[model samples]
Target: MTDRIRRLGMTAARFALSGALLWLLLSQTDASALMARAAAIDPRWLAAAFALTVVQVVLISWRWAVIMAGLDASIGTMRALRINLAAFFLGQALPTSIAGDAWRVLKIRSLGFGIGTGVRGVLIDRTTAMIGLVLVVLVTAPLLLARMPDPAMRWSVAAGLGLGAALLALALSADRLSGRWASGRLSGVAEFGRAVRGLLSRPVTAIPIVGVSVMVHLLAGATMWLIAGSLGLPVGLVDCLVLMPPIVLVAGMPLSIAGWGLREGAVVAVFALVGVPMDGALLMSVLLGLLLLLVSLPGGLVLAFPEPGPGQAAPRRIR
Candidate 1:
């Protein structure tokens, strides 16, 4: 009951934060202009962006399957797709982004895999995707840095880089650190770390996994470009490539519901650097969110009418 209360409190806090941020942003922007931008959206471009959003989820789900393969667990791409879609919906509906990840882990666990393997697969998948985003930001660092001459903005970028580097280091060295706990009560931790080391040790395996993640981010950028185009925003693909990663990185934070307020704020702030109006950027971000939700609607259906394979019973509890 205590844990449930704590979870409820956290959810309430996130809802409050999301509401406050949105209120602040919406108050500053011209409501009429925002509605005008929304009204002027090009259906053709919107459709294209929605299609790309579907592709992005498929690629991510495929990456999940590949990650499972590395862990010596094989849930074919189709199965991964089902799980990814359902989790995607859950991620959007739940309080935090981690909820989606938890759903993925739970689904995998339900497939009869040990809890340890399921956790490791999801962790590595998430870590590699983070590395991919970091690589994207670093690759375009020069352009991004040149555009932002403000010291504060520079420090924001620097802090982002520092955090990315730290995560990369921790992921690479987790196995070594797990050794100390090998004989301890935390056997699961040791096993997870060793699994990470083994999976990433092979160049052949590691390269493709990371590559897929990069592709996922790149595809997402393209989708964003299309979203901007739909709203007739001045932001270009190159601008999206250079700016969207940080926006994405920020939006990925679990601070708000489905990245609602954080994503809108990040979109407004980052695109403003490229001369996009705040209202336009906010509209584009909201449209992007709605379209993404629409694309994942199928997942809600999948979750509603789940099918289990013969001899495999779906676990009642997600732990």
Candidate 2:
């Protein structure tokens, strides 16, 4: 009961925050101009953007399959893709982004894997994605710093870099730490850390996993770029690449429903630094968010008509 109440309170708070942010941003902008720009978007570019979004999801699902394979779970890419699509639907429906992760872990457990394996598989997958985001930000660090002269923005990027480095350092040293916790209640955590260490020790397998992870974010940037093109915005792909990683990292914070207002505000703020109009940025962000939601709708079908369980008969239609 207490947990339920706490969740409700959090959900209410996020709703309030997202509403407030959207109201604040919308109030300051030219509503007519924003609507006009949105109306005038080129359908061809919009279609292309939606297609790229689908590719991003598939690539992410494949990355998860690779991670599970490393852990010897072997769910196969197609099954993982189904699970990921379902999770994406749930993730967007729920207030917190991490909700989908919990769903993924549960789905894996249902597939007859131990809870430990499920948890570790999802954790490593998330960590690799985070690492990819951080690397994208760092690789474009020079351009980012030059583009956004705000001290706070630079510091935020620096903090993110530091966090990523610390994570890598901890994973590299997990072998020594895992032994200490192997017999404790936290053995699961120790096992997870060891798994991270094991993956790092094998570059041949690790490289492709991380590389695919990077491509996922790159594809996301491309989606944003295509959105810009759809709306005839002045922003370029390189600008999207520089601006997206951090904003995406922020949107994944679970502060609002599917990053509704937070993402729009970030898009406006960051893209403003690049000389794009605020309305254009907000429109692009809104379109991208809606397209993402649209693309994940297939997961609803997956949920409604789930795959048959092992040793169970598949559902049949009546003539």
By TM-score, the best candidate is 2
Task: Candidate 2: list runs displaced more than 4 Å.
Answer: 175-187
Model 2: per-residue Cα lDDT over 1-319, one tens digit each: 9999999999999999889989999999999999899889999999999999998888888888988888888899899999999999998887877878888998888888888789899999988887787778779888888896889888887886788779676754554673555657666566677787687578865887889888988888888999999999888899888888878977887888889999999999888988989889888888988998998899998888888766678878899
Q: Whole-model lDDT, candidate 1?
A: 0.84
Compose the digit string of candidate 1's lDDT tens values, residues 1-319: 9999999999999999899999999999999998888888899999999988888888888888988998888998999999989988988877877877888888888888987788889988887888788888888888888778698989888886988788677656555663555556665555665676676788867777888888888888898999999888778798888888988888888888888899999999988888999898888889888987898788899889887754867768767
Clash pairs (backbone) in predicted model 1? none
Model 1: how far residue 45 lies from native, Å:
0.6
* lDDT by candidate, in order shown: 0.84, 0.85
> Pairing residues by index, what is the TM-score of model 2?
0.93
Q: After superposition, which runs of candidate 1 have C-alpha atoms over 4 Å from their true positions? A: 177-193, 310-319
